[model samples]
Target: MQHLLLVAATILTSDPVPEDEDVVAGWPGFVIFIGLILAVAVLGYFLTKQLKRTEANRKAGVFGPVDDEEPRDPEEPRS
Candidate 1:
């Protein structure tokens, strides 16, 4: 049993592909290409949505300035 297992393991681990063989050919390649394009498009859509939301928040003063009080002269002492 041990010898059988050893032989089987050696055969399974050996390199299966020959130099002449082409990888990712035909229909499989087309499917992968389309999947990659769709992934990028979906990512871009969400990114654009987030950026627009942030811009809207900024314009609406969701992020307040450092000084809420009116701008004072530099020489004026802080109360």
Candidate 2:
């Protein structure tokens, strides 16, 4: 257990430091992230609207009345 703990500690503490240029490039990097968030929000809004319409239609039975058709073999006698 001591050996495993030492290996885990070393791995946890070791991290690469970012360079000066990487640290300074903030807004440009964030622009793409912000754009992705907006796109996802727009898509979610449209999907919600479509689902609401479908649910309303389902409640109203807009597709038409349900048929009472039954499946039967060709050789079976009809009532």
Candidate 3:
């Protein structure tokens, strides 16, 4: 957990950058930090939406045989 925070802190650089060069430096840094966070959140939302849709499609019918053949009891004969 500590390592993960450290990496995030590193990615959100706090080194002073000139206002004129602020575009990429992210000036106060929180600017880009917030943007990056939002971007990830939006992507995550869309990803989960897709995942749910796929899971719904994969859901099995509640009242039908699972496969083409009828499910047989353990005691049923094959002969």
Candidate 4:
């Protein structure tokens, strides 16, 4: 138990040494980050445009006639 305690104290007192100081996210990483941002922006813009067009088409009754009837309860029998 005395030898184990001594070994633990030595390990706890040692300083950590870094292997490399030069490793970093350089120009390639920055370029890829910018690319991902642009891709998400473009996709969001297109999605909004498509949704607006679909809403306009639905209002124009392109798919079918719009129902003007009141919503019926599921418990009620169909007339």
Best by TM-score: 4
Mind giving the per-residue lDDT tens digits that candidate 1 earns over 1-79? 9999999999988958756556547898899999999999999999999999998887778886444456888898766
Most accurate candidate by lDDT: 4
lDDT string for model 3 (1-79, tens) is 9999998898778765668655564466888789899999999999999988866655554434344366677797754
Ranking by lDDT: 4, 1, 2, 3
What local lDDT score does residue 25 receive in model 2, on the 0 to 100 scale? 46
lDDT of all predictions: 0.84, 0.82, 0.74, 0.86
**Model 4: residue 68 alpha-carbon error in angstroms:** 7.0
Candidate ordering by TM-score (highest first): 4, 1, 2, 3
lDDT of 3: 0.74
After TM-score superposition, what is the CA distance of residue 33 in candidate 1 from its true location, in Å?
2.4
What TM-score does candidate 1 get on C-alpha atoms? 0.52
Clashes of 2: 0
| Tens digits of per-residue lDDT for model 2, 1-79 | 9999999999888977878776764788799889999999999999999999987886677966433465567797655
For each of the candidates, the C-alpha root-mean-square deviation to the true structure, in angstroms, is 6.2, 11.1, 14.0, 6.6
